[model samples]
Target: MAEVDTEINGYIVPKNSQIFVNKWTIGRDSNIWSNPDSFDPERFLKREIDIRGQGFDLIPSGSGKRMCPGFPLATRMVPLMVETMIHNFNWKPKKGMKPEEVDVSEKFGVALQKAVPLKAIPIKL
Candidate 1:
């Protein structure tokens, strides 16, 4: 909640009122990002921005009081789990699905997720 009546970016925010930021819009803002809508993972290599709340550009897990409690564990465990899976099985997309055909569309709801979840066939090695 806002502490006092404050004007931010020309918008007046009432005192004690809740404020929400649309993270999606921030990611797609052309002013802050070049070709924001395009898939360019290399952009990160061009600049140094912290994801752990220090920098506003990337805070998917949030920061401070709102930070995800499992962020530390998740960060460490996810890569190991993925590595285990890759080592144990040969993976492929669902039948008839090409590498580029997989849907990358987002479903905006209580939580963001893929509109069409990836269906993979894992053959135990």
Candidate 2:
């Protein structure tokens, strides 16, 4: 909720109005991202960007006072979990499925998820 009436880009925003920031769209804006539609993790390799909300471009966990309290926990746990999974098992797509044939479409809801459930076989190492 807005604390006071404010004007954004010449438009008057009434006081106490709820404002929803579409972070997803912001992330995909071509002006803000290079090759926005493509999945490129390496883009950040040479850049210094903050994910804890300081960097306006990427705030997956959000930023500022309203940011997710679990950010710290997630930062540590998520990587550890991924490392453990990679170390313990060898993963492959379901038999007969080629890696390049996997569907990467997104299903938007409370959070964006794969449009089709990813089915893979994990063999214990």
Q: Which stretches of candidate 1 lie over 4 Å from their true place?
A: 1-3, 38-46, 111-125
Could you give candidate 2's per-residue lDDT for residues 66-96 as a string of tens digits?
7989999999999999999999999999999
Report per-prediction Cα RMSD to one decimal: 11.5, 11.6
Q: How many backbone clashes does candidate 2 have?
A: 0
Q: After superposing candidate 2, which stretches have Cα over 4 Å from the reference?
A: 1-4, 111-125
Estimated TM-score for each candidate: 0.70, 0.78
TM accuracy, model 1:
0.70
